[model samples]
Target: MMRGFDSYASIVFFLIGIAFVWESRKISESSYGSNVGPDIFPMGLGAILVLLSIRLFYEAMKAPKGDSDGKTTPDYKRFLMIAGAAALYAYYLEDIGYVIGTFLFLLFCFQTIQRGKLVTSLVVSASFSYGVYYLFVQILEGTLPGFPSWLQ
Candidate 1:
């Protein structure tokens, strides 16, 4: 199963690399000089991805057969919880404002998922949210959504 997963991932990466390489050719090269063309970064990244995917594919092909059987499967419940939380965060982010939404999301993850104390989770979440807000909005002069109109 693990080898299968690796093989699938490698194939996906290989396809992505091909797409990037193809798309890079369409970018206008007029703005960038001869040496540093518009396609340079995409082409470089695509080449690297292709090479890494080939290496991963080869490794997966040569890996021991029993490794997959011995390894434990990932927890679906935890995956679902995290995904659900992320979806919820995206939905509520603009409405609640960045600080409040982020605080609530972190608190939910810490308390519900990580089984942390309510007070500790709340404090940590609030502190982290405030720090991020200060760094991005206040210090960097980046605009973030203010308190929702309904809340005002």
Candidate 2:
């Protein structure tokens, strides 16, 4: 049987995509002397999201009836931990800087999801956090809170 969660998620994603697309139009249509506008990325992402959500809904609906494997209990505690960590991460991203905030968040999430493998988790989290920072800040020349003002 198809899970109701899948249907709900599809609807949510579809709505979010619609909102993004609609809101993107409010941004200025042209960038100084450039054909590409600031809205292009968001609009493209929204379009992709809309398409993926529709595909997900279609797949959910088309699944064979009575095909569900036995229900498995969700780990609500882990879910809550991750969710809370994510919220905190967002709030502290600017204060602590993207690299530190993301590293801490990812580390917490990794350990929360699966205990053990401390070394692996640390390496992976560090790699991801720094990689994203380097890509966006250095390569793309985008601004992100680097380090706390006190540290700089």
Candidate 3:
């Protein structure tokens, strides 16, 4: 891994996270009389991003100074595949619903990053997708497109 790249990325991510948090604050609180505001997700996500970026920066700095100039080729095919999947996920989300769409997307991404271990990938993807859906819809009283009618 390129040490310089990681350091630079950490800085960029830190800034982006800060921006997310800052911008999310502008959103109006409480939509349609619901306790959960539209800003809640973005604010929480931004906070998490900021924390993660700080950790990334710390790890990047603390890690040993490895090859600072190792130029590895980017995998275009995998990039295209993941990009295609993301686009399809966005396009089909309303129709397919959040849990299934997110699960499929995460599964595709995890498998793309590392093939094999289908069980691990499937379980992780499913758990995260369902957990998020449950948390948002039930606990937070937030609405999300649930399973498609076909599945229900």
TM-score against native, each model:
0.54, 0.73, 0.88
List per-candidate RMSD values in Å.
7.8, 3.9, 2.4
lDDT of 1: 0.81
Task: Write model 2 residue lDDT over 61-102, tens digit each, in one string.
Answer: 886665453466788999999999999999999999999999
The lDDT per prediction is: 0.81, 0.86, 0.89
In angstroms, the error of model 1 at 26 is 13
User: Which of candidates 1 and 3 is the stronger one according to lDDT?
Assistant: 3
Candidate 3 backbone collisions, by pair: none
Best prediction by lDDT = 3
Please give the RMSD of candidate 3 to the true structure.
2.4
lDDT of 3 by residue, 117-143 (tens): 999999999999999999988988888
- Model 1 alpha-carbon miss at residue 52, Å: 16
What TM-score does model 3 achieve against the real structure?
A: 0.88
